[model samples]
Target: MREKLQLIMKHLRQGSLQKMWKQTIWIYQYGRRYWKSMILYTLLGVMGSCVSLASSLISKDLVDIITGHQTGRLLSTFAAMIGFAIANLLVSQASGYASTFISLKVDSEIKNDIFAKMLVTDWESLTEYHTGDLVTRWSSDASNISSGILNWVPNLIIYTFRFISALAVVLYYDPTFALFALLGIPFSALMSRPLLRRMRNNNQKSAAMNAKMYGFNQEAFSNIQTIKAFDLIHFYTDRLKTLQKDYISMRLEFQRMSILTSVLMSIVGFIVSYSCYGWGIYRVWSNAISYGTMTMFLSLSGTLTSSVNSLTSLIPSAISLTISAGRLMDIVEMPQEDYSQDHAVKLFEKQHKTSGIGLTMKDLSYTYHSGTEVFAHASMEAYPHEIIALVGPSGEGKTTMLRLILSLLRAQSGEFQICAGSDHNQKLNMSPSTRKLFSYVPQGNTMFSGTIAENMRNVKPDATDEEIIEALKLSCAWDFVEKLPNGIQSVVKERGGGFSEGQAQRLSISRALLRKSPILLLDEATSALDVATERKVLKNIMQDTYPRTCIVTTHRPTVLNICTRVYAIRDKRCEVLNEVEIEKMVKEF
Candidate 1:
């Protein structure tokens, strides 16, 4: 039974070690560009350790010089010590700078890779993680991985060499002295294994709690106005206190385990120090070793103890790095959006260069992963120079249809295509790349924090003042924009904080218009505007010189007057209605 238990334990230990090694190798790959500096940094660290040991050895020579009555050589011997000191200083400074440079470089590379991956990952898959969790991984976990690659690995290597060199010096004078000094080595390492495991589990939980707290705070602050109006301040405050209490409890538990491991190591360290001292004194009294040599043994033994402690500390650090690496790899390994096979983007770009295209859907079907069927056997078509209105009661997939049209959500089964103008008359299936052919203005104020001109230039970076004005005029936004003190250059707050909902909507529409894509999608973009203003904006859009195929999701009846075709969506189906039918539906509302 004992042998069987030992065999099982051996396999478990090997499995854990193999897993940690793989994670370390993966993190190292991210620092490949800085590997050259990292190697030099480790070499410098080894040299610094060598200098420290040399100083301890030279102290023996100084003792010998004084006791043997060799006073004449004291000046030259002290000069040698000074030389080692200067060399150590230089090596330490160089290693410090190299480590900093490597850490910063690896941090930047990791962040850039994660950011690029997030941009190209499938939209629905990316939404599985909250914004706060993603940000925390990007900022905190990435830094930990960087430190693992550039700092922890190199320090481990340097400290191992230091321990070996110090042990050799002590053993040269008296082998038993080295054994006494290393009595606590195995104990320290063994004590840390369970502590390391516990620390890693606690760290993962703490990280999750922190992300939840961040998400809660972000949601609360973003809806502060709603909370104030509803008189829910105490409710939010109490919720915050609860979250903080949980966080504090988690942290305290981790610290308690760490302190227990520290106490065990400290006890072993005290025993080792006293045993080495007794062994060294006995060797000197028995005339087996000289006084100078005995002094060197004690000094080098202390050095070995310190090096062992440093080495053992790395076990916990390595565990932390493994957790961080695993968190970051979760995002990096997710399925990315396939851009190489996007034939629709190529076709749309070719067709839209000269003229616009109409959208068509045939026998479309879409069901959520939770088995909620959003659309089934749905079909619709709209031509350029035409305005199509998607009218439906709330929760009837009006916005879902607009999202499907924009390729933000893909259908489970269907033929959704875009057919070009008369010249080429090519047909292509919708994909991620096809999104480039459409300019979308989603619900609410989507304006970023920037100057009005800056926001307009986002879709068209080189749009001149004249071009910006033209797009704004097309959206009926120039009226208010021109009245501002700085006109288009006026600074806008985040989410259009200083602007009314109606004004922000017009700005968002103008930014989309500047793109001049073949297709335009307005998903409740005009819900905040009055009837007269909304009507004027739609009129301006339809009369613009460049032709466009417009699809709007709206519950407002006023927009129906200008729509060339109106479709009502209900019960997972879309039905086209004539003007009379639309009038009857409007009256029923």
Candidate 2:
């Protein structure tokens, strides 16, 4: 008791109570949305409990009629007993079905809402969490909240009503019997205080471990190719065994505590139950109450004990719900992506359609959260109908630069903007809403499991076969796609399986081309293509009538000859290279 008090005081000092209160309010908000359904469920449960109470009373009467051999009223009482039993069965099944359906609906809707929010969350903020961790919260934690909202609250109310109703019947028939049934309540309450504190801590550890295990499994499957290449299959299997042992150890520790508490509660319950049974027998021996009345008293006393047990069981469930809410709260409450500039971005696109858009960066500086500076005072430009190149060795922030331009990462201090014309006077600052103005193909096989045509239509969902073919041809992907047995309709397996890496890269480029944004960013997107084909793809972009501004990051100097301008990234800065400088760097390469 002292330890539990100390724990609570510590939490009060740390403001955990305030946090718990906020979580409760968050849960209530979800409950408020489905208040009508919850109210209906509660009514159904109360109706079921009432029917059960009536059945008990009818059974008492039938017992008395049979003992007395009273033929006059026996038939009617037995028939009434049978009808209540059937009614109880029907009500139980209907309510159970309704509860399941309602809970599932709640789960689906909550998942959809959380899934959308996570998609729009700030990319930089989301990078702090692993993919597996996010998924566990999205799936398991969200489910716990949904089930608790529909199940826990209704069960609490129904069980409380059952307890009170049962106690009332026992009191009406014989007040002394109620006292014997009440003997277990004090001991159960005393055991709960410490159990609750321990349960909360255990749940936190258990939830975190669940996330780690889930993340480990997801990553292993996703990187199976790498694992096989390195011949680390046995290593991975051994690691999985270690994690399973840890998980099982944690579950068993909690289970032992639960078992201990259950045994103690059971002891008290048994004592109270037997006392009630003995008192009823004593009354029957003394002829103070009839056998039927004694039987009724015994039944209601058992109901009282079971009902109390059910009500107390909800405490652990409530803790689980709060824990789940806190997990979800960490995710959904982070800074969301700001789309306030969307309307203005669309207007800019409409005005610049004919001339296309260009990019201008001046006096730009950026550093990562880890205090590693990517670049400082960087400056660059890409005019319409031009191909600009950023060349650098590894770890010089080529991909980081693309992320900055795409607004996936924020620069500490800089000017990155898009302009309607090459002169760069007319400009709008870059933001999440500006992402629609550019199409990007990062370094990877970005194809999902779908048809070749479906992959192309990801950027333009309503694209026709002719438009799809045109984009593929522009990216130089038409050669292989046209040769496929199903042509544009051929299926691509997961991670672009059944296709070479270069082919997947070409298809990704094709999807970007289909979007037809004014500006295109290709980060190492063409590294897989042969030099001749790579040069040909860039030429196709330049010859297109859209006046598109193309920016590419590459290590190859072969394509730099066709570029409008080249910028070398090194020494914590971006330096524009002249013809002499470009040639000198090509010789160095």
Point to the candidate with the largest TM-score: 2
Model 1 bad stretches (over 4 Å) = 1-34, 69-72, 285-295, 341-347, 423-425
Q: Which ten residues in a row have the lowest lDDT in candidate 2?
A: 63-72
TM-score of model 1 vs. true structure: 0.92
Candidate 2 ranges beyond 4 A from true positions: 1-7, 69-72
Give the Cα-based TM-score of candidate 2 against the true structure: 0.96
At residue 498, candidate 1 shows an lDDT of: 82
lDDT per residue (tens digit) for residues 82-125 in model 2: 99999999999999999999989999998898899998888888
Please give the lDDT score for candidate 1: 0.83
For all candidates in order, the CA lDDT equals 0.83, 0.90
lDDT of 1 by residue, 1-589 (tens): 6975885588577796677677878877776767776788788888888898888777778777877823548888888888888888888887788778767877788788878987777766668899888888888888888777777867888999999998887777678787898898888767765767677778789779978998898889988989999999999999999999998898888778768777877788789878877887898789787677878887887778889888878877888898888887788777776666366576566756656788889889998766789899989988778899998889889888877887767899989988775533477777777787899999987999989999999999999999999888888889999999999999999889888999999999999989988889999999999989998989888887677888988889877978999988867888898888878866876
* lDDT score, candidate 2, position 291: 77
